[model samples]
Target: MKRRQTPSNGTMFLLLGFSDLSLAAQTSLFVFFLLSYLFAVIGNGLIMLVVTFSPRLNSPMYFFLTVLSFTEILSISSTAPKALQGFLKAGRTISLIGCATQFSVFIAAVNCESSILTVMAYDRYMAICQPLRYTSVMTVSVCWKLTMIAWIFAFGNAVIGFSVLFNLPFCESILIAHFFCDVLPVMSLACGNTFFLEVFQLIMSVTLIMSTFTLIICSYVRILTSIFLLPSAESRHKAFSTCGSHLVSVIIFFGSAMFVHFHLGNPLSPYNDRMVALSYCVIIPTINPLIYSLKNNEMKEAIWKLTLKIVALHM
Candidate 1:
């Protein structure tokens, strides 16, 4: 009898995206996701360019918003393209190395996004809770440093998370039940003991997710206290107007992420998992720009100006 080859680094993972459906259904799904991708890119791209060039948006809050827009683009781009390609391509395969790379990028984006959101909450907290010291507290250098730290921290986390799987052997059946590469899905393929890895991943997830959430919650608690202490109704209304968008965005991202991560390993609900993952990884990022823009006066004005500039150039 011939000795069977053990799957190693060269193994390929079939991304089994979207259930096997009719051609029409698949094509429709592709079109929907493609449009969503374009919308998110354009929305976030315009936000970045406007914030970079618009003098009116020179405040620390907008600076953080710009960081958020860019991060949103990066986060969604990591997973969406490959998932969209799954509809058109057969098997939708990626090499073990490629899968690992994708997971790292996706996870880094997620972590960076969470960090930025936390920082943004702090920005709002400062602006509202400490108006006199806002500029001094949120200096240009400080903002830049925070942004860099978030990026560095996220990437470092990804590196450490994947290091454990560096030499782990994969099973012969490499079919990933969901779209794109995710931490749990990728780790599930390993033939060796992954209990500690899963535990570590869960701990990290809870730590970051809950910690950031607690920070945001604490900031908001202070913010609400500060807002209510204001003598004038107009001031309280203004405070709400300023902070409402970020709060909505926070709920959206956190809600989706918590659902997906916590609800993993339900043997009876693969399709439910797929749907939730699709919405979380694809839909949420796309809608986030719209959420921020819809309520933001500054962003709306900037987008309008950018749109006119484009039309004028064409003419």
Candidate 2:
């Protein structure tokens, strides 16, 4: 493939992903990422399967877990394939429409993931603090509605943000200094005034992230209060254990995201930005299933039973 040295508006944008590194380094990263991407896909896929088919895991919590796993798969998949391709070849170009679509999907998936996490926290809150009302509140219909609302809001936000960004003229070079077409990098290439757009993006990002994170924090505070008030040590331990996986997941995801979005400085260099984004975008999703499964006894048992059933079928 020919390398594009110069790109402009209405043309393709060349992704310069880790091209500054040595060939050996790029190859190693390629291999590592390929394996990680596959593992993430398969791990999240397994989570969805177990949560869906295992009747033993029929609570609203598990239903939310299925939604999370699906969103994780979508989130990682948006960039992993293109990133892997970039590692193999130079001039990994994406058309304007293609880049816009990828960014849109990525934004939607990420926001959806945050929304689902917040909902999961609320689910836990209801189960622990309002156990008497949990069944009546978090019915199957309610769960489905919550999931739909998350997706709808996510895509709606993504469409609006990207539509404004893409409508701007681009007269500068179109070399994206990252693996994928991220908002900041793509915005850097636009010719017209982007201050308004940047402000708009910042507002939107903060609103989505901060709102969900605040709700999750509030839910956990109430949950922890209830757990502490429990009279029995065994019951308190059980309650804490139930929320352990989700707490860890929330920390890992939001920690990296906050660093990237709210750091006190100029924008991160391409290398640093890629490293930070790679953690939540790929690594977190890959290990999320393990976090939930290992922490939750019910999930572990369901997975074991499913594995046995699968092996028996093969035999």
Candidate 3:
């Protein structure tokens, strides 16, 4: 009789180190993530609603803002709920396909956001710096085309990234170290050597991130120079106020992103990895709508009107 080969221990599912988290800590994490998810959804949803209903927000800037809100909502939804469930259940195991799908969605949303932000900066430049030609330059057709390009670019990137992972044979290890199914964390679980894939992904990610960030920075610099040359104090103040919130949000999103993608080396500690992931994935999305709406007067008024209408309806 031929003997059957038994699966190795590494091939079997294990709890990994997350099982060591204290019960209180797990409970706290679950609650924290749950609240974060709710805020992310509600905040972005409100922004979408305001942009959709307000006639004053029918411009290109608000259109991009609506798309951004949608992207942020999708990005947070990709991982936060799963992480919360894992915290509550004390089980962190995810299937191979599930992890890959999560990563694909996340990468798509992130890449789309980067490109959309760059387009938004250009839109601001036209509106503030070249006001006379703004309407002509940024027509409805142009805006639609640009948005389509951003989505196509993001979808292509996601497809290519997932294709790379699809070819890899998973070893017995299915435990991902991070709270979410990030590329680095998921790649770490592959049984076979993945040095080439890791390097490729790192290069692609850095290139995309750096290029978009550079465009945003250059756009803002030019915008500032233009503002400074403005003869009217009121004009300068308006431009500064308009750009301030966007600048802060961009810094928070891109800065945290660059730090995690560029600074963190392989073989990351679980705690540090989870913390960094939470900052970008959970905290940033939850705070972005608040930052933008609070800073912009138009958005604030729109929200106020929306609230009044809802209250009046219930009366």
Candidate 4:
């Protein structure tokens, strides 16, 4: 397939998303993505609402969980719509500005998710390892400050990265191989040298991902050590259980994120990349409410209470 070289000022870029696939496959993906997108939005939105209103959930952990749910909503919203459109139609076109905006929002959301997860890990560490000082260390004001920092860092990185990436001359081709304006796919379309941009992206990816991952790992290590030191096995199990949901979330998110960002030369194929991206963007957000809520007794209890209250009101 040949593409005509378009000027950098080209307003629209064709997203060649799954056009090569059979109609049946595309239609199947359309249905699947539509359902997944809806589930992700509603599930994450519900988690946020429950955590915000439930008096029993008024803790630093739940506060951070609310932030995480909000981030997941943003993450799914950024890519799932474009992806669904591409699956529904052969070639979906997105304006350059629109593409840039999507990329910025998605990147910010990803960054924020990682940062918030790290904060949650720290909260767990404080609770488990320093139980007496947990309240003092993770107070409401401090939690708000930390959450604000995450938001500021995410948006700052997104704005800087977007400005650099979009300024590049994309005279080679306008057809983004993937559904969304991902960094690599758009970078591949650049006509001139992208060495600086590539390095910048690498730096950003490594810094945001690995830094948060390391912090989480360190927090978990301390938490585990503290759990082991507990006198009774029951207490140890109880302490470990509290961190279980968060640990699972971290693993799922970072596993896919690392695979996508850390690899050279498309880790398998373009389709595989899309699948992995889909997992983190759509699957993760959709399943996060389940991971945090189903595995968590408090979350389940809160949901049950909230549901009953709604039922009574409706009755």
Q: What TM-score fits each model?
A: 0.93, 0.95, 0.92, 0.94
lDDT per residue (tens digit) for residues 11-87 in model 2? 78889988899989898888878988999899999999998889889989999999999999999999889998887
- Per lDDT, the best of the predicted structures is 2
In terms of TM-score, how similar is model 4 to the real structure?
A: 0.94
Q: Rank the candidates by lDDT, best first.
A: 2, 4, 1, 3
* Overall local distance difference test of candidate 1: 0.83
lDDT of 4: 0.87
Evaluate residue 151 in candidate 2 and report its C-alpha lDDT on the 0 to 100 scale: 98
Question: How does candidate 3 score on lDDT?
Answer: 0.82
Q: For candidate 4, write residues 1-315 as lDDT tens digits.
A: 334354444478888877888889888888888998899898889898888779999999999999999999999899988887876564498988889989999999989999999999999999998999988889899999999999999999999988888877666467788889998888888876777778778877888889899999999989899899999999998998899999999999999988887874334587877777788878999999889988788999999999999999999
**Model 4 alpha-carbon drift over 4 Å, by segment:** 1-10, 265-267
- Per-residue lDDT tens digits for candidate 3, residues 1-315, read 222222332332332424458888877777888999999999999999999998988999999898899999999998887776676445566665666677889999999989988999999898888999999999989999999999999989999998787555565555666677777765665665678887887789889999999999999989999999999999899999878877887898899878887854555577877778888889989998988888799999999998999999999
Model 1 scores worst on lDDT over the 10 consecutive residues at 1-10
